[model samples]
Target: MPETVTPLGDGPGSEPGGTPGGTPQPPRGGRGRRTALIAAAVAVVAAVAVVGALGLGGGDGGTGAPPRSGSLVPVTRTTLTERTEVDGELGYGKEIPLPVRATGTVTWLPRPGAAAGRGDTLLRVDDRPVVLLYGALPMYRDLGLTAARPATPAESAPPPAGPGAPAKPSGTAAPRQSAPASPRQSAREVKGMDVLQFETNLAALGHTGFTVDETFTARTAEAVKRWQGSLGLPRTGRVGVGDVIYAGGRIRVGHAGVRVGSAAAENALTYTSTSRKVVVNASAADASWAVRGTAVRVTLPSGTTVKGVVASVGKQATAASEGGGKDGSEQGGAATVPVTVTIGDQRALGRLESGPVTVAYVGREVKDVLAVPVAALVALAEGGHGLETADGAFVAVRTGLFADGKVEVSGRGVREGLRVRIPE
Candidate 1:
């Protein structure tokens, strides 16, 4: 009895007597997987707690390290301001019109596309020795000698005494007043009297229908009235200031008109004004940048450089064209004042009409402004000004006019003459 022991289960390879081909088992695979998952979760929590304690999680985790001090490379900067904007147009000296000489039909007008300059011949007329008839009067005369007229002693008077009064001299002649102008003396006197000579020549030319005088008189008035009547214009009885007349047939030339042409009864001549050759328009707003006498370096569409001097600046605003997209979006605003720049080369001007060009204006510059490297700024985690200091400290700076890899900065906390560090 003492040695006998009951067998509770199957031993080794033998199955339990009461069961048929069955055995008890443990959940080993499931327990191993669960244990591994719990260990991984604990490890993650421990790492996060360590980082928070070390202040490596930023302020969000109520733990952040103090900013470190570092060295910075000091640099100076300038503030550039835009002054004025202006529009410019191109023109050539050849644009001036030339009148036809001798009246036959303008045998040849300069070819449509041909260019000409101040001295270039524009139109040629038929052959005819334009019968040159002197005007009843000319505007100038070469007086052989200076003339003097006898003056009454009473008329020669001394100047009144005053701060600028002349002191009496031993032999100084008394100043004399000019005599009142009379028609008779004026007509006879030829001392530097161009108007009188002009009349004399006209009289000699057999154009006696008019009398010459500086002042338009009844005779000249009658002549003008007659001419205007013949020309079918209102008989205003006044000769236009610069009007001209010829023999063969009558042709009228306006003031400053008719460079090489003549009025012959049966000839047709070209007419042109002899004033300025070209005109340009540009903007007042941009005028500040486009100063007078500025040497403008212009780059044309073909990559040619044309030198020009800014001649005139507009005082007021003017219309201008601005850059725009096909969809009507604008690239920039248009200039208000139109500035005019005169180009010296007539050939260069002729080639620049309506051509693409780039113009740069250098205005006033500001120097010695506090500046920082552009790369030093970091988008802040707190949504505010973000710039890194040389000591690795975070800072906020007010900045302006970013150019040439630097920005102008100024603020209450920022100061000049202070050594600061820039982080690498």
Candidate 2:
């Protein structure tokens, strides 16, 4: 039989734990239930205390797992201190655009885009202008002076026999021969011949105003002036060898419907610009970072290395060359003021033709400073952040020089040997 349970101050025939009045006996089962409830409550309290200490009860004020940390290594002491960071591009300092020197058919000795040296022949003139002169007295003299003298009719006279002596006509004067014809010379005769020759020569040209054998009179000079005006020249009547002459600008040769002919028109040579000046302007923000004489390096299409130096720093802000400027400074006005960098070696010019490149500048260096990856430093809300301590809590830290992906952090709360968590 199970042990019988008893209530305090209760008799066998009375209610369990009842006062002394005669009452019916309470059930042993009720007494046993009260005792069992008390025991179970005590066991539950004990279990909760164990769980709380073990951190299983999350609200028990224990941080679940320690934050992860990475080891730090010593960096070369000479690498710290950089005040400014800037981006820059490469460009040319000086350039020359070769322009058209004379007007004629376009021909290039070295095909377009070819390299040229000083004194290299670029092109040749196709025709040489020529002049011819002639005398005019021959025809005029024959019509006037020579024909003016009338021949006297000879009187009929018997001819003397050659073999046997024959009687000659009495009173027959010997026929007088006209004096040898004297050539009459005159400016008009000479001038007329010149006019004819000039017309013939002018026809040989491309219907241009210039002509050979043309009387080089005041009219000729005026015509030359008109030609000069059309060609954009100073209207000077005289021309020398190699002087530029143009029938009209934009005149092309060897085109459709134009017969190819050798004339003074072909002699006109035109000069055109094959190259130009190009420069790359840098931003003013880079001036302080990029000091004068800062060395820059670049590579060419041929894998050739080129060197350059910082030549100037902009004192004011101005529009940039590449994409204009920033803010409301206007389309071209907003560019960062210029910082000019000239190439140190001329050989580098051969590789550059006014294009893009890379530039770098060095800044101040520091020594023997405690540093870590910039990622490890957590900026504090007040002024800076903190780093994780071995205890899993962040400690306030003061930071110094920041450069090359590293920063100098120091404070009483942080030590060189302290393990700090770097937030991923």
Candidate 3:
């Protein structure tokens, strides 16, 4: 007789051949599941044994060569960067004070948002145009012969030889010392540096025929008269403190300080650079990337990305806004250094004039590093992580920067083009 097979009985505590509805089947279902689980476990053990023979680094597998197939990736040589983004504003940089020096009624002014460039009228005083000049120094004194002193031999003379000073070598004369100035000359003329600065701007405005020097000669007067004639003003041949406004570069009117008809006071209006730039109140700790000449990236309100560079970093720190949960309130706001970033491609900004922008700052980077997919690393029982080869061998690696799903790895065996097995 063939051996009899005991079918899975229904319910626990029920023996084979008991009644058809012998025991509670719900109770029996649990036992049946346990039996199935045991069988599944046995199959898994068999599968693991096969993997051991293939030599996984963490398992008691054979030290065989890496296999030729199965999820594999090659080590790559590339650069890994850690980037951080901060909130920024997109507008003409910081608004600088552009006060007026001309004493007259605000008879005429540029439009509220109008821009001005070299030789352009910023505003009108007594119906005369107040021109714009590119320079760092402001005109504090009139530029005319009255304030200029000649650079004569007396001015260039060296100081007299000190007591007991060594005599000059034979056939070579010593430097002559400058003589003491008389009371009439002791008061001194205006600083020559100021003159040089004024003349530099004067020369840049197509006004030539005079040497750009500290001395404002008669030729310089002639050039000034010509410039005055072009501007439809009285040919005074002199530039007073109120005649022009000195600025770093092209400027755009930002805010009007007073009404159009108001008397022109010391403060006229505020202005900023004409081009759009990004300003970030970066945390003082993040100033490393906020240095001048550091490259960065910017995202516009339209979701467009462009390149930029750090233009300047503020020396002072601003206190963070206190409190929270209110409109414009921030909590634990970090004290920040003002950072100015400028973009080269202005057209890429499209029509975005002023709005919020995101600035990406690079913190740290490792270049020309050998890297592999993070998934390829296996935790070692001994400690740390390792990369398993295809054939069953393992390559111990020292891990570095973890970025963009790739890890920087270096070791005796880690090298570019080396293939490593990845887990499924």
Best by TM-score: 3
Q: Residue 232 of model 1: what lDDT?
A: 53
- Candidate 1: where are CA atoms >4 Å away? 1-74, 83-95, 99-102, 112-120, 127-291, 294-309, 314-337, 342-353, 358-364, 372-376, 381-386, 389-391, 403-405, 411-424
Worst 10 residues of 1 by lDDT: 246-255
Candidate 2 lDDT, 1-424, residue by residue in tens:
8998655457655555565565544665897898999999988866654443233423212233444446544323345756332333443332222222333443333243443322233343343221111222111211011123433545334455688786668999977765654433211222346344333433433234644453544444456566446445566554433332222112212112112332223322223222222223445544455567776555444556566566666666765444443332333433565556666565546745555544445566677777777777655434455565545455566778888888887766555666665655
Flag the better candidate by lDDT, 2 or 3: 3
Give each model a TM-score. Answer: 0.38, 0.37, 0.67
Compose the digit string of candidate 3's lDDT tens values, residues 345-397.
99989978889888887877899999998999877656567787766676677
Root-mean-square deviation per candidate: 17.5, 22.3, 13.8
lDDT of 3: 0.78
lDDT of candidate model 2 versus the reference: 0.46
CA lDDT, every model vs. true structure: 0.46, 0.46, 0.78
Candidate 3: segments with Cα more than 4 A from true spot? 1-46, 49-72, 145-191, 285-289, 302-304, 322-331, 345-348, 378-398, 410-413, 421-424
lDDT score for residue 409 of model 2 = 76
- Lowest lDDT 10-residue stretch of candidate 2: 137-146
Candidate 2 lands at a TM-score of 0.37
